[model samples]
Target chain A: MRQLIDLFVSFFKIGLFTFGGGYAMLPMLQREIVEKHKWATEDDVLDYYAIGQCTPGIIAVNTATFVGVKLAGALGGAVSTVAVVSPSLIIITIISTILRNFAEYAVVQHAFAGIRVAVAALVVVSVAKLFKKGVKDVLGYVIFAVSLLLVFFLDVSPIWVVLAAIAIGVGKALKAGKGGEQA
Target chain B: MIYLCLCWEFFKTGLFSIGGGLATLPFLSEMGSKFGWFTQEELANMLAVSESTPGPIGINMATYVGNTVGGVLGGVLATFALVLPSYLVILLVAKVMERFQNNRFVQSSMTTLRPASVGMVGAAILGVLQSVLVNMDAVRAMAWSQMLSWPNLVLFAILLALYAKFNKLHPVVILAIGAVVGIVCKL
Candidate 1:
């Protein structure tokens, strides 16, 4: 019970402060759980991040639950998951109640303008970081560029892009593709 | 019957929404069109609240849309349905994860997933831009030059510079800056 409480509080803090969503939360997760608390290791966090990415739902929430479960068990996972999400849930609930009427108010309207731009900036920063970290080789770079264009210019369905990429990846693998660029 | 529909839609969403919450947007847009269960405008409102407030944008949307359509029970049901598959799949994968996690096939699949996810995120961002960037009808009514708002351009530059300088800064910090700028500029 005490361990679960600790897990919950730590995750709650993660949920409250984390900006830029799941991927942005990775370093912080590393710091708190792996470095500070010793609740988990660096590899654990990375594994969680990878799994979180491939799986559905929000990466941060999924990650918190994964770590919590790994560290403690079912109770730990539940506590941590809820702890991390409660802030956003409560805040959104309140915002929803107010937003229906207050959204177009002059002040709100003005505030959102700056907010939107900043969010765009944050997105751009994240994209750049992810590109650097994930796209190391020529093939990866090519895929990234092609994917971006397909989405931006062609307006193709995302599912198709994912499927096509999978086919290419599998094709490369079958051909014994060797190199940093293979994947 | 309704719950089944929710389950199916959210299940498919979870399976294909490999990137993250925002990736679900295009799917939601299509679902809205197909089901006639919600409107695009409502979905936008859901997004605004979802992003501003809480958990995953995807989770919040599921709850919001679900609850909006079917009450509290619906929200809970939908939320669970959306996350259920991922949890199960992850739990199973976690078992053999260490052994095969970095295997070539795994890497290749992930590599494939990377671009796909990027495309989805990019598409969602574009969707947001279309809605938030300018008033569409006004742009159509007037010339392109008049539609070019100086505030957005300057704000974009400021953010770009700040981001470049503060490479290590958290994304939330920029979000905070955006909020402050939002209030000040009345944009």
Candidate 2:
């Protein structure tokens, strides 16, 4: 009960306040999970983030579930998931209802324009962090550069990039097999 | 039927956007153009709000996009779509956790995907930058004089410096700081 309420309140706060997306959500997650609630240690949260990245679901939600389940159980997972999404549900409902008029206000537009730059800046900063942490070797760096070029210059779908990497990896091994060798 | 379309769109998002939600920026931009379901500004607004909100960025974006198209139902459909692939993949992996945990194919595939994910994220960044920064004739005109204007550069510098210096700061602080910077720049 208290645990569930806490989950809801924490996630509602997260849903209500986080801006600029996943990377931007980190500091908040750190504060709530590590500082406020002590649900996860900084190291544990960092590990959760890494696993969050490799996993398919949304990073924040997955992190919530991971923490919730770790703390409680299946019920905790559901409770936290609801908690995280609850604010979004409420906020979006309001936005949907009043959206027709929200777009026309000059003050609103100006605020938004400012927010855009801020969002971009946050993302750029977060990407630099991810790169520093994840890009371990020369091959990793080269791969990063290539993906950037493909997505930016060519507007290629990232799905294809993953597919191509899988092929290159598997194909190289197959070729090595023909030559009677293994790594 | 609508749910299926929602699933397909998000399945595409999940299957690719390997680096995460930011990696989907370009594709979402294109979707804005294709479906006319969301305007460019609206999508930016969504990105901003979604950033501040709880849940996943991809899920947040999907909810925004879906709601714009089909209300609460649409939002639910879109969220489901986005999670469908991950749920299936994770479930399968969970079921088969022991047999292939150390398989070379799996190891190498992950290695390869890491770089690939970075490229996808980089591309996403480029696409978003182009969309946001280079609006219309000014971009095409290539006016070098204003390109590196001191004030714009200063704002960029302050923004970057602040982020690097305080990466742990709440995003709202960053936004508030940017607004102040914008007002200062204008004056």
Query: Which predicted model would earn the best DockQ?
Result: 1
Please give the RMSD of candidate 1 to the true structure: 4.6
Q: How well is candidate 1 docked (DockQ)?
A: 0.40
Which residue segments of model 2 deviate by more than 4 Å?
A1-52, A60-87, A95-100, A172-183, B1-4, B39-41, B141-153, B181-187
DockQ for every model comes to 0.40, 0.38
Candidate 2's displacement at residue A100, Å, is: 5.4
Q: Roughly what TM-score does model 1 have, to 2 decimal places?
A: 0.75
**All candidates' TM-scores?**
0.75, 0.75
